[model samples]
Target: MLRFFRWYCKPDLIEDIEGDLLANFHRTLRQEGPAKAKRKLAIQIILLFRPGIIRIFNLSGFQDHFKLIQHFVISWRRIKSNLTFSLINIGGLGVGMAIAMLIGLWVWDELSFNKSFTNYTELAQLYQNRTFDGQTGTYKIVPQPMSRD
Candidate 1:
C-alpha cells in the first residue's frame, strides 16, 4: 500500500503524504476493522492521483525532438543498409589519413632539422649533375671537396 502511494505521488510530496497516509491508516485501523481501514486508504490514494499530485509527462518541444530522433534513425538505417560499402569507405579513409600524417611528420622534421644550428641561415645545399652508364641524374649529394676555392 505504501509502495503504491509512493509510486503515484510526486517526489516532493511523497514523504509528507506517505507519513500522513500511514498515520490516518493506523488511526482508522484502531477505530474500525482492517477491512474498512484498507478501503479508506485505497480511496485516499485514488484521490491523490490528480494533476499536480503525480509527475507530469511533459514532452516540451516534442515535435522538434521527434524530428531530431527521425534524422538519427534515417542516418543509422543508411549506414546499416550499406554496411559493406560503409566499412570499405571507412577503412580507405583511415588508411589515407595515416599516410597523410606520416608525410606531414616527415616534412615537419625536414623543415625543423636546422633550427638548432646558429649558422643555419649560412648553410647551403650542393647539387651536381652526373652520368653513370646511360642515365644522368641531378643529385643533392656531391663528392667531398667539390668546392676547392
Candidate 2:
C-alpha cells in the first residue's frame, strides 16, 4: 500500500507523507488490530490521490509531445520541398512492406502444412516401381506388397 502511494506521490513530499502514513498505521494497528489498520491505510492512500498530492500524469507519449510536433513540422517541410521524390519513396516503402507481409504469410502456411492432422507424425510417403509397355516408372503409394524367400 505504501509502495503504491510512493509510486504516484511527488518526489519531495513522498518521504513526509510516507512517514505520516506509517505513523498512523502503527497507531491504528495497536488500537483496532491489523485488518482495520489495513483498511484505514488503503482509504488514506486513496484520499491522498487528489490533484495536489499525486504526481504529474506522465502517460504514454506525454513526454514526446513537443518532439512529435517538431517532427511533424520538419517532415512536412521535407515533403513539401520535393513532392515527387517524397511520393516515390513512400510508394516504394508501401510496396516493400506489402511484399514482406505476403512472404511472411506464405512461409507460415508452408510450415503449417500437414500439421492439422492427428496422425501426421505416423504418415510417410511410399513409392514403388512398375512396368508399362516395357517401360518402368516409379510412383508413390504401394497398392500391394510382394514377398518371396
Candidate 3:
C-alpha cells in the first residue's frame, strides 16, 4: 500500500505525509468517541493538499469544448444506422404482405365465380357441327335433356 501511494504521488512526499496523518488519526480516534473521530477525519480531509481533488475551470477564456461534438456525432451515427435497418425491415414486410393479398384476391375471385355459376358441373361449350358441304357450320348447344344423363 505504501509503494502504491508512493508511485501514485510521484516526486512528492504524499505517502509519508498521509502515513503520519493516518497514525495521528488513529491515535486521536482511540482517545475520542466515534462522533468526534468522524468530525476530526473530515477536518483532516478538507485540510489535505491533494492535487487530484482540485478543479481547473477556464472562467476568463473560452474552453476547448470538443467532447460535445464527439458525443453528438456518435449519437447521430447510431440513430442513422438504426433508422436504415428499420426501413429495410418494414419495406420487406410491406412487399410480402402486398403480394400475399394480391394472390388471395385472385384466388377468391376465381372461387367466387365458380360458386356463382348455375349447373357448374354440367356447363360445357358446343363445338362446330360437321356439315355435308366442305364449309363447317356452328351452333351453341346445351344438354339434350336433363333426364338423358
Candidate 4:
C-alpha cells in the first residue's frame, strides 16, 4: 500500500501525505486491529488518486521556457555565423509578410466599402454586363438620375 501510494503521488507532496496515511494506519491498528488497519490503509491510498495529489505528466512552462531559450541561443549563434544567409532569409520573410499584410488590408477595405451608410445593409450595387467589340465585360458604373425635376 505504501509502494502503491508512492507510485502515483506527486514527488513534492509524497512525504506529507504518506506521513498522514501512516499515522492514520497506526492509529487504526491500535484502536481496532491489523485487519481493519490494512483495509483502511488501502482505502486511504486509493482515495489519494484525486487530481490535486496526482503528478502532472507534462513538463511545466518553466522547464519548457528554458529549453526554448536554449534553442533560441543556438539558432542565434548559427544565424550570426552565417550572416548573408540569415539576411536573405530574414528579408524574404519580411517581404512575404508585408505582401500578405497588404493583401489582407485590401481585402478588408473592399469588403467594408460603402458600409458606413445608414442603409448599408439594404444597399446593393447594380452591375451591367455588355458585349463591346465582341468582348464581354461586367461594369458597376450604372447611370441614374440623382434628383427629381
Backbone clashes in model 3: 0
What TM-score does candidate 3 reach? Answer: 0.29
Q: Pick the candidate with the highest TM-score.
A: 1
Ranking by TM-score: 1, 4, 2, 3
Report residue 93 deviation for candidate 2 (angstroms): 0.5
Q: Across residues 1-149, which tens digit of lDDT does each residue of candidate 2 receive? A: 88899898999999999999999999999999999999999999999998998888667686589789999999999999999999999999999999999999999986676787876665445778999999999997755434331
Ranking by lDDT: 4, 2, 1, 3
lDDT string, candidate 1, 24-74, tens digits: 999999999899999999999988888888876567789889999999999
lDDT per residue (tens digit) for residues 73-135 in model 3: 997787688998867877999999999999999988766654557666665555668676688
Assess candidate 3 and give its lDDT: 0.67
TM-score to native of every candidate shown: 0.47, 0.44, 0.29, 0.46
What CA RMSD would you report for each candidate? 7.6, 11.4, 17.7, 10.5
- Cα distance off (Å), candidate 4, residue 82: 1.4
| Model 4: CA > 4 A from native | 1-59, 118-142, 145-149
**1 or 2, which is superior by lDDT?**
2
TM-score (C-alpha, index-matched) for candidate 2: 0.44
Give each model's clash number. Answer: 0, 0, 0, 0
